[model samples]
Target: MTSPHRPASHGIPRPRVWAPLHYPGFATLFIGYSVSSLGNGMSAVAVAWLAIELAHGHGAGLLIGEAVAAYTLPGVLVALGASRVLKCLDPRLIILVDAIFRAVSLALIAGLALTDTLSPILYVSLLGCSSLFGLLGIAGDLAATTELLPSELHVAANSLNSVTSFSASIGGPAVAGVLIAALGPGLVFAIDAATYVLLAGAVLASRRYQPPTPIVKSSSAGIRDGLRALWRFPALGAITLLCVIFYGLYGPVEVAVPLYVSSVLHASASVLGGYWTVFALGATLDALGATSIQRFGLWRMTIAAVAAWGVCLIPLGFTTSAVIGFIAMSVGGLVYGPFIPLKKTIIQRSAPGELLTQVAAASGVFTVSASPVGAALGGPLVAALGARATLAFSGLATVTTALVAVAVLLAYRRRTRKLSGDR
Candidate 1:
């Protein structure tokens, strides 16, 4: 058994399902990411709980919404501008710095809560400040994955990364609930902070396989270059546009899910909870053993996954029975799990190594930016269409978009092959 630390052959042999774990650096990176995911799980519960605690009687809902917005919106803002700064530094440094800022800021929030001096202004500011580091992720973590792992193992590596977050999604909230019950929500923040500290340590200890390939360009030029590369590559452009459509259309479903369960299905809140749990469970199970899908080819698998995801939602819209709906949602979750890792693997494999980080950043901004637009549209759509109609539209739109992208991708491949033959 060869150590994952040593470089290995780039053979596309039968998918050694556990091949990625052999790479010590990837293994270390995996652990750090998994821990961070757990912390994120805790943070989600803590932030919402704390917001409720700090809210007076009036405008409590508004305050909670604002705090959540503060945590998320800043990353979009930072991602827009940080590409140039990220191009100038090692991505690992950016990740480490982000982790450190989050740790320190979370600790401060805990301290303030303990002292009975926490205010909405201070709370929002700390969370916003802490979130700014996440914008660096466009260039850091996924880019680091490309740098550390061989091309053959990219899918497996991303699968592991995706699963870590899913695992955390399940465990983080449970533990956070226990701590909040025993101690308080503030303690959850402190625990989350400690997880970041551990993540930073793991990142600090791991090695980079490639040197930082710094791009020498003005800020405007760097940003332009990143944009131009995406536009220049038809496949990349199509995939990104597909991402925008799929993500935007899917956003409405988030709003529709709870509404459908409560109003349409006439189920308890726990049933809605079961809906998500089963979905996550399906995703986790699929990710753990998805290496076989690689045999079908990355592009085909990606297209199929997106279409399958949309297809899964159709059953949800048509079904009235909670059991049947749960089955549909679970299938969606199973198919949805592989889509992201496959997408990331495709991007990293196809992108130029030098511009990989910047390209990823730009794509990240585009895709993430679409979700809010989708969410904003979601409320109105649900009002107009109703939950079942909205869910059906969201699913159908996703499928239509995937089919269109597949057609475009196929045409592009034919042209490229023809041009190569002509040359």
Candidate 2:
């Protein structure tokens, strides 16, 4: 990566922002992004809790269930369109505008909370808008990952992003839960609103960047083309299957966790938040050593993440102790970064430059797009099947991911051998 300027060191720095031989913008942007992301974590819990209250004495977990659906449903349905939007706009502009968009959406949520007469319909709309903002957020992330790092350094860059994300995740839920319980959800929203100001400031301050990939010029058909491109790879068949299982299994646990704590453990809302923080901490730990994991190999990392995540789910599902469950949750979180980064790296490394963006968006279509359906299923499954069954379902999903990924890797290996022989 070419540095436009030398990095300015500040505050117990993690990496240089700029250097002729190194890229610090990746870390800098990710750090800023992590801060905003932490605020988002807080907002999400607060929003879920607030929505539960609006459900008028229903279990707060139920509201979390619906909120998950409302937020992720759009990601599935609109990703193709979002891909097209990215095609037409500059990545930097998109990043800047998205910051504003998120800020507005967050402010709206806080405003509603403060009115003391907040309506259910209004809350739903604002929450829905936040999800749409997230759609853009993911697009911006793909752009940053592509523009900021040289291909060879993807693992290190991804590790940084994972750490930043996990750190924020660890802090957001615990803080949000406490703030909501003590001062009410409105204050959580207020804090979130301020973070947006900080987020926008960070983006605005960034050095200018634009990708070198040629434009596909098929903005209108970007989604159609993106979806169509999936057929070009047989591995995607298994990938899709794995994604369904993973999301289906895990989404319920997240949706149901708050209720499980409140009812089963007699924990306060603040305590519930702390429980989530533990889970995030586990994920952060994974990112901390991601550099070492990547040194082993991306394919190996994917397999490990899938298989370990599955086994971890078993203990997590059965554990009555929050501390024990959190320990398991942390393990699961560690597994999160390697697979995500590997997925992106694998796809980018394989595809031609101009097509990288579309391929990345295709991933969005696959991973997040399925989240709502998972959320929708989570509600009824939790209501009827119970948490253990739900947790078991997620474990099953992980097993499927591991099995399918191994199969695909073997097949790809065979294909490469055949091509080599022909040559």
Candidate 3:
């Protein structure tokens, strides 16, 4: 039986469920995220392909990695700055600008690839575009968490938002990979550009959510306070710390997987994209079962799923075929559903209303930082140790991290219970 204290579950239907705290604003965000995730999936595909081209075409490993750096490094530097401006701009306007800039960036990448003009100058432009996109995302996050809802539906809003990306991860890359193979990178990039157009259209259609307050603060003290709250507040701090560990392990798994397939497994490019499609589909399926996941124990299950994900990687190291690798990734993706939402809910619940965006942006910033670091380390590690050994070692590290997280959470929970009893 469920505990009396469980949050109300919104019964929508099998595979199509809702949270009781649902608001119409989340629906808008959900539509936007789904479309945006498709675009994101394509952009990521382009980046990895771009990396591969740079490394092999010019035989420069650092050059390829550097190209991708334009995408990630700026998120770390600009997250706080974005949080400050997020308070001033209309969230929708920010998203529109973000989409436009990113679409232009994709067009630039395609132009460079098509005309044979790929250059360091182009990479710098990619960096600038990525920075703008990151800021826009921070604004969207804050707007989703606080400005969108009035009466404490933060957890549900976050979960629904998660569902959108989950869906896009399933469909976008699978198709893009095929398109990239059939038509080339330019078509894939154009598809992403179209996705942004659709996303802007979706935002235009949604009616219910408007920013409740204008957040034009005179000083960015609000940004500073958000960072301070993360450290000062125990729950938010703990969740953030654990999530950092999760993402650190998760980084190489997603970012480096394509590189692994081509370089190590000797798989075709089409197969690599399909592998991600399978993984994303699994994640989507996992999200569908959120209601069941809650009753069974969210924390313990997240721990087990993540650890199992690590264990799955061990077998992936032995796989010679792309089919085997895709199967392995899909199995890992099965756990991804509950894992992401549980992590997000932990933060949304822990963060206070006023500082929600800053907290969310901080989380994004941390993820942004850890992923590249993991990839940077993984890339050379793959080059040095070979794919199988590097994967095995990464797998072990992930398991170790999960074990530490479980122990930490258990200790904290026990102490909290004791205090409650004492009171």
lDDT of each: 0.77, 0.64, 0.65
Q: Model 3 lDDT vs. the true structure? A: 0.65
- Best by the TM-score measure: 1
What is residue 182's positional error in candidate 1, in angstroms? 2.7
Candidate 1 C-alpha lDDT tens digits along 1-423: 111232222344545757887877767767887888899988877888888888866677777877777777687678677755666766677778888988999999998987878998899899998888675654588888877777777778878888888877778887988998888888888888888898888777775533444544444544456677678755556567778888898889888999999999999988997888888888877875556676666667778888998998987778799988988988888998887777776677656677676777777778876877797799999999899999988899889878987887678768877987999
Candidate achieving the largest lDDT: 1
TM-score leaderboard ranking? 1, 2, 3
What TM-scores do the predictions have?
0.92, 0.81, 0.79
For lDDT, candidate 2 versus 3, the one ahead is 3
Residues 115-196, candidate 3: write the lDDT tens digits.
Answer: 7677755755674675566654654655555566532344445556566677766666667678778877666766776777
User: What TM-score does candidate 2 get on C-alpha atoms?
Assistant: 0.81
Expressed as tens digits, the lDDT of each residue in 27-110 for candidate 2 is 556656777778877876787788877888866666666665665555455665665566775444456666776678768877
